[model samples]
Target chain A: MTGLVSLFRRLEGPQTLGRGPAFWALFALVLAGALAYPLFSDGYTVGNTVYFFVWVFIALSLSLIWGYGGSLSFGQTAFFGIAGYGYGILTINFGAAYGFTWIALLLAIGMAALVAALLGYFMFFGRIAGVFLGIVTLAVTLMLERFMAQTAGPEWRIGAARLNGFNGMSAMPPLTIPWFGGPIPLFADVGLYYVVLAMLVLVYLGLRILMNSSFGNVIVAIRENPERAEMLGYDIRKYQLITFVIGAALAGLSGVLYTVWGQYITPSSMGMTAASLPLIWVAVGGRSDLTATVIGTLVVLSGFQALTIYGSQYALVFMGVLLVLTVLIAPNGLVLGVIKGITKLVTRRKQEAA
Target chain B: MALLQLRDVNKHFGGLHVTNSVNLVLEQGEIHCLIGPNGAGKSTLFRLILGEHHPGSGQIYFAGEDITTLKSFARIRRGLSVKFQVPGVFKGLSVRQNLEIALQSRLHGAALDKEIDRLLAFLNLEAEQAQLAGNLSHGQKQWLEIGMAIALKPRLLLLDEPTAGMSPEETHMTGEMVRRLNAAGMTVLAIEHDMAFVRQVAQRVTVLHLGQVFAQGSIDEIVADERVAAIYLGQAHA
Candidate 1:
């Protein structure tokens, strides 16, 4: 247990850790909870666990851009919706077959990245500030929503046999592992759960690498003080655009995975409500630490699931209260505050010993 | 030939002319100080040189090339660097990481680390190399800003009130560091209100009042000028 604590502590960084034994114990408990869910849970519970992992990917992407890059976006859902629809349209409507579906996913991510580049180019270059950036992104979400709504009409609608308008696209084929001879049955919820778990691990490792690279340092520096970064000979807009695109691509990947899990893609997923979830996850998880974001997602989603089962409408009220309290009392988020408190307690103990 | 030259630079906000046709020349390896009363457009002229703001009507030449329309980042890439009146180090980055970013702008691959280490030792920031920049003292922040400007060994460094909020000892230390940098063959243009510090280090001085050059000469010449003294007193004694 001590060795495991040390490993996670090393991963978290000295700036993020506490020196207290109590804090380590609590951290260990949380890690055990996260790792044990898939192992002991039934198929239905594991399916929800898979859903949470997919959301974790989305939350991580948001944490990178909004939390680290300091660019608040309300257009992330557009990337998710677009990519999901792109995959569905390519595979189902066009009958592009199996290997081509993977290619389609990549193309969807690239398209989403290109859109982010275009949006970031306009916003950062134009020097749009604060609420104006919010408004611009909100406007983009509304525009995409309107475009998807209109697709139900004559111009682009593939009829009731296709897109299905607000009803969403469904009946996506299950992902196949060609090495295993044929497609993994989508009905095998446990199998899908493991696949999602592997993807989440891979995505987490990839993000960790990107965040530690020289390019990631540039992104964080830009977040801290863009003017200073520019004075230091960095092309601030270029970095902003690149970070935005990378973040958008990550969202696209999550969206593709989400469609696979739910086997559906709806226009509502591209709306403001869905867009805001990832931001909330980043805020609750703590912006500075990526692992905190995953924990935050698990905590919030678990609370949400529990509330829905017990008291349907009241669950949303509980989340609202929790968000307000977290913002007012622990604006740095729960994980960071807990770490700091533990560190202080440890320092106080060492002083007493001396 | 002058490394940088400004001719007939004018800036106006409403009816107020902040800079009125100010002319100046900065030769290679010279430390030029621009000093005047508050609201005399000293910092405004610095902004013009950095391309943060364009002059109403004027021309700026850098390395004998016209750079009147270049953006701030472009000018920085072209060997012009400015440290703000308020130190602008990224608060989240460690001292070494901050230096590394600056060094990366000029050097790539294997040489980056060596350059960063050399800069860390030169700026005396090796002790707190792992500390976040926000943890640094005011004087250290000022030095870090200067270190960032000199990262690529820029041909010209423009400092706006480098020691605006430092103790006497810290100010003295900053003055010594500026001298060391100047002696190392980098041209410096410092905007300072500290007459004593400017007198101690400046090779030349330019004085601006109500948006125009009130006087221009050595520090001794400007300080001793009768008209310059009256401008400092807010009296029309020209």
Candidate 2:
């Protein structure tokens, strides 16, 4: 019972914003509204909203890696591609009977994490930092994209699944759960939407608890001053690698979801443009805080989609301009800055009233 | 037995010999100070002890165990700690958070919170416990850094210029802080430039010149030595 209390209390840690009874009430109200969203919306609209939620995992992954752990990685898309392809190959080969699809999902995510661990070992142990680390990660990402783009040959087939190269892979099974009555498919509809939303809320609260815990404190300390942290007796490389793997796994979840959403996985998903999009989403939201990253990613994604529908050529260009402005005007994060402003105003008003 | 022993330590950067055949010893629970002129390699020696830079030759023994090749974190886990030349406190974290991080390795639950409170009170930072360490005054940052180091309950503490950029009063308070740590059974090896601060804390002192130990004695004896005055202290006296 004390453990449960402490976990909930830790959600108000200083590393993140939003606390007190007012914040909790607002949080509960927002969640209730999200839960009721599909009831009033059409199927297509609800599915579109699910697309936005799917990308949050990737954005939050970047926020954890670059914002908190102090390593900017362009390789999130690489992990995404790896997991998406892994899932497509596994499900296409084994078939989804008896819900082997869930096992495939776990294995695909594990593959991404393993790759991340190996890459992180080399980069972190090699002592790569700052822009050099960014360069190395971008190089790895682009290298993977180039390799996958060339696998269009018949020799690229794995068992029954085909690596269709630039055209990408398709016909993978959607995620299914083994229920008592029968297996239920989550095909990017309201079912998948609810599952993804529940996962997001759990992940957000779980991360808050983690960042407020001792391990989380050490990760932030490493971000602040690695040498100082080392002198204080932390093996900073181990911590960095762990954070990297966790972030990569989250990116992998997005990959699997994206594949299930359209039943297709494409090489362009790992392309240069795709790799940079998550960075913009994270940076524009305020990379340090998870809540800011989630809100920022959803808002920017909705705006980008609207632009793509109305003025397709201007969509990417507008995103670029927004990223530049975020860097220039609100490098800490636009959403986070605005939230801080409101918080200050409320506190001041309370004091005056008192 | 000496708490820390460095024997025939040599380090070179290209042709320049930084720490040359240096030999030193610190008995447990003594406040020892290293003093020298600019480029005397005092800070370099501290780095060598902390394992940031390994010695070109010779060995470092802490608590009668060879720690010459252990990684810095490993050495720290073996009861060594450091407050670096610059204030290395986590600027993005709160003052209390900084101490909590330091204490977390050895404490948890209510014990961790209790230690954090004690450290904040000890550093005179209780009022600003929630303030960011970056927002602290220079003296407060230094104090917070000191609080962080002692929170480890280390057997040996290496402090490089603990009182740099401090007012005389703050410097004296730091001297008192070091003495208190020493009284609580920590062996201290500090590199300092302030003579008053040294006189207030150092029971024994070592003078280095040109990467060599030129003199070692009581603070008064070293102050009275003409050779020590000629090499390093004369400039300070001037």
Highest lDDT model number = 2
Candidate 1: misplaced stretches above 4 Å?
Answer: A1-42, A154-161, A185-188, A340-354, B107-127
Task: Please provide, for model 1 over A170-226, each residue's C-alpha lDDT reduced to its tens digit, 9 standing for 90 to 100.
Answer: 886655444447544544377777777777776765666566666777788888888
Cα deviation of A279 in candidate 1 (Å)?
1.8
Interface RMSD of each: 1.1, 0.4
TM-score of 2: 0.97
lDDT of 2 by residue, A215-235 (tens): 889989998999999999999
Could you give candidate 2's per-residue lDDT for residues B121-140 as a string of tens digits? Answer: 89999999989999999999
Q: Runs in model 2 with CA error above 4 Å?
A: A180-182, B233-238
Clashing pairs in 2: none
lDDT of each: 0.79, 0.92
List of clashing residue pairs for candidate 1: B20-B211
Q: Compute each candidate's TM-score over C-alphas.
A: 0.89, 0.97
In angstroms, the error of model 2 at A249 is 0.4
In the range B1-238, model 1's lDDT, one tens digit per residue, is 6989999988998898898988888998899998888998988998998888898999999999899998888988888988899899987778988887778656765688788888888888989899999999988989888888888688999999998888987788888888998998889999999877897789999888887888889988987898898888888744
Alpha-carbon interface RMSD of model 2?
A: 0.4
- lDDT (Cα, 0-100) at B77 in candidate 2: 95
